[model samples]
Target: MGHAADRRPGTRVDRMMTVPAAVSRSDRASATREAILNAAERLFAEEGLFAVSNRRVSEAAGQGNNAAVGYHFGTKTDLVRAIAHRHNGPIERTRARMVAEVGETDDTRAWLACMVRPVTDHLADLGRPTWFARFSVQAMADPGYHRLMAEESLSSSSLRRALHGLQASTPHLTREVGEERREMFRHLVLNVCAVRERELAEGEPTRWPTWDDTATGLIDALYGLMTAPMTPIGTIRR
Candidate 1:
């Protein structure tokens, strides 16, 4: 039976609310839990949550048995959350700090950059954890997984709030234009992120694509088309 089955069904509510009485044993248990989470994060990123087994996570983490996953996190969903929390925690802190610094500034660009850069920079620096990135892409493609991710570690409200703040600060953005343009921009950015792993596997990137490169050209063309209506379309049409 899965570790989830072992938990009493609906009887014990509010698990996180209970503070375990401090004891020497519990301290060791907590440390073991952290190690498992760390190992899970690394392995999950490389092998993907679906591809990796709990046993593998246990072994990678130096926990000799599968019970470690269940001992710390009751379900796979909980494990995913622990991984996301670790990955996103620093980015969240950096974003908060950036927001505070940009709070009094009149620049919308800075605010927007602050909002987008942290996540992208982390992914770029770390290189997509193969497993995690695959899982993310798969989740995006599959409705059930998408919902699972949304329920577990995802929140759209904060991103929406950031966009709203940018709209408020930026004078040129009309409601319709901002909504359309921002949506397209975000979609493009996400595509770039999702494709990075594939790009790395194909070969080393040397320079920016020449105009002949279809992918780059297509994106550039779409960017221009999307922005065209926002500015002087008639003058530029000819």
Candidate 2:
């Protein structure tokens, strides 16, 4: 009985010792993964979709060999997908929260900020606005990335639901035209913001305008144009 008891302690110690080593390995792997993602984000943003290679990502990540990208993520597509996925979660959650917060407000201004704040704040938090911003523009322009974005982003049903909720919350937007136009205007805002981001990163003179100005201008113009009664196109010859 004593012999068995003595062996029990040794067995427990063996198990306990293995855990920290396993945990340490896991921590190392996690750190490596973050490094790889950070490097990939920069390269993809600066160079565009096709410009960045798996080998370059690995090298920039400080990994020892080409196997790292494959070993960790299996493929270039998978790695970029992972990076996008990682950012997408927080973004979606923030948007959802803002949507909910605006639920009680009757003002469309509050609702408008709810829809746009998440995006602007996300870019602000990234600190390297150029990285995610450029990637976003590329995604918007590239059919492949657009499909990927649609897949990862809120589903159509979810978007409609959110829009319906927003319409319900904002009493000023009663007509179908108002609601539909608002949604289209929101998309326009996203498009303009993406273009501005790309221009800023390309070292072009952004002194022509600011992102916020462009954003607000787009939203205002859209709101006015969509809400205003339509005039006959050819009749407005003046």
Instruction: Give the Cα lDDT of each candidate.
Output: 0.59, 0.68
Q: In order, what is each prediction's RMSD in angstroms?
A: 11.1, 5.1
- How far out, in Å, is residue 200 in model 1? 7.1
Question: How would you encode candidate 2's per-residue C-alpha lDDT over 94-131 as one tens digit per residue?
Answer: 77776666555555555556556566667656654556
Alpha-carbon TM-score of each model against the true structure: 0.56, 0.71
> Which window of 10 residues has the lowest lDDT sum in candidate 1?
206-215
TM-score of 2: 0.71
Per-residue C-alpha lDDT of model 1 across residues 46-103, encoded as one tens digit per residue: 5556777787888888887777888778777777767666656666666666676666
Against the true structure, whose TM-score is highest?
A: 2
Off by over 4 Å in 2: 1-10, 104-108, 155-160, 165-218, 225-238
lDDT of 2 at 208: 31
